[model samples]
Target: MMPQQDQPANPAPLGLMAFGMTTVLLSLINLNIVDATLEKSFVLTMALFFGGIVQLIAGGIAFKRGDTFAATAFSAYGSFWESLAFYWVLNSEPIGLAPAASARATASFMIMWGIFTFLMWILTFKHSWNLVWIFGTLWMTFFLLAAHALRGTEILLRAAGYFGLVCGILAIWASFCILFFEHTGVELPGASRPL
Candidate 1:
């Protein structure tokens, strides 16, 4: 009797993860560019609202695929940011005596997100150090800095911006890796390497 041959597993889930990461990176890049170049409230609002929506959707799909930590973290924070941006868009005015009230609100949100990221880091500790975790950690750091920046701190804002840039670059690189694998069946050398 001939030996049974093993079958290859579906690659769709991995592809989805890659796609989600890519979208996130692109959105981050867009936001960063707006911050660095235009510095307009409108641009920031649009980026946050639209990007948050994308992240929410991607996170939802990831959740369905059993990436519980990623799903919850992304979906929760994405929704929070988007909703906050929408609130500001509709209100168009700061609340009372908060010293850039909008900034304070943002800071609070970031602090919450940072806490979630820490949880995610703990959950994923057993996993290998890869682009996903690296970006995840960077995302958490951005939130931490954002929290500080919202307290009228310029240094924190600068630090957050630098970290955001790094996150964006990693996201873009991860996206290209997926695109490459999808099209040409080639793999990168690290965590995203082909099985």
Candidate 2:
């Protein structure tokens, strides 16, 4: 038999860290803890670079590693970030697409994303508790934020922001787990083995 090709280094940690840090920053704004002044571009920059572009690149690497789940998750969420940034730009004064989408439209977007997250969360059961919790809490965050937008309720948004913050923390922890495992060959408590 021919020799197997050498495998590339793990890229999931980079993907997870990108998504996690971006989620935390946005959650802070959603929780109204950040200044509105940075709302215009700071978020957009992260969305396009770290969240969108880098995540997508990591997803492609996962695909090369034959990890369909990682490929899907990274790519989908990367697209989500890109689409979100595009939406913001489309409605901004510079572009003026269609007079900005309504809160209901945004709610619909979140609901769709919630459904997607729940579906993916179901697939995480065999992976690890960390994986399950990450996607599971993310599912709730999306639905809760959607509910708030649809109903024009502030409380749900706050609740969703807190939930998203938790998801981010979990993601960051998982990322560190992968990176540490690669370095020291020790698995972190709740995280799964690297893909």
Candidate 3:
């Protein structure tokens, strides 16, 4: 009989941290807690490198580990960050000079992401509470941003920022839980239990 190949290390935690950190930074800007200039100077760089490239690498590792859910989540969000960074970079001065997306177009973009996240959230029910909550707030954040764009309402944007912050924090906690389990074989709360 042929020997089985060793399994790859879990990649979800790395991807989760990447996503969480970038989301938190962006959420801070959305909340007006951080200087708006940082979005272009700092956040976009993080989105392109850490959230985008690193998460893409994690997605590839997850695919190797035969984790379809992690693979899809990491890949999709990685692309999202990359595309968002590119949107700003291409539109800003001394770059490609591409016209900025209109509010309608931005709303449409966010709505599409919201729909995608909602579908993914439905799938998270079979996973764990951490994932369920992470995806749940994530979809809400996307929808709230879409609503803000569509209605030009500051309240909706603020609401989205709050939801996004929660989602990012949850994701970071979940990442630590996974890392803790992998290191010490102890499952953190809500990490191994499904609803």
Candidate 4:
């Protein structure tokens, strides 16, 4: 066997930070505390550019680092953000603006994401409980949002937003933990530094 070479750096923090910040901003809008039209446009831009493109790059790096989980999670969710942008933008059509997606369609879309998150959360147990909680809450948030969309109720959506906020905050904290772990050499409360 060839001698193993030094591995590349971890790519999780960049992807996690990108996803975390985007989620926080979007969750604020979902909470119904902001102007929907403006915030949505801005959020879509960030989703396409930062969340989509940047996370894709980070996932590529993770693949180079030989991390299957990071590669899969970051790349898949990056594509998800790009798909969200496509829905809001190109969905209008070449001739005339199409009608908004039906509630059922939207709910189904969210439910699919919930399913993906559930699968990813199962993988996160190997990383740390902090990562697990982030994915766990995020999984629930998607399902809650989907249920609210299906029911046409603000209550459930708002609840999902709150859960999303928690997920976002936890993700950011995890990113920080990974970034600073080398220096501190001690795990933060409810956080971990996965290799």
Q: Specify the highest-lDDT model's number.
A: 3
Candidate order, lDDT descending: 3, 2, 4, 1
- TM-score winner: 3
Q: Which lDDT tens digits does candidate 1 get at residues 25-97?
A: 4344434544443323644454475446656775776666576665775676567557655654555545432
Model 1 segments beyond 4 Å from truth?
Answer: 1-42, 45-50, 91-105, 126-128, 132-140, 143-147, 189-195
Q: Residue-pair clashes per candidate, as listed?
A: 0, 0, 0, 0
lDDT of 4: 0.85
RMSD of 3: 2.9
Candidate 3 residue pairs in backbone clash: none
lDDT of each: 0.53, 0.87, 0.92, 0.85
lDDT of 4 by residue, 98-175 (tens): 567888998999999999999999888878878899999999999998999889788998999999999988888888
TM-scores for every candidate against the unseen true structure: 0.62, 0.92, 0.95, 0.88
lDDT of candidate 2 vs native?
A: 0.87
- Model 2, residue 122: what's the lDDT? 89
lDDT of 1: 0.53
Alpha-carbon RMSD to native, per candidate: 6.9, 3.3, 2.9, 3.8
What TM-score number comes out for model 3? Answer: 0.95
Residue 137 error for model 1, in Å?
Answer: 4.3
Model 2: weakest 10-residue lDDT segment is 1-10
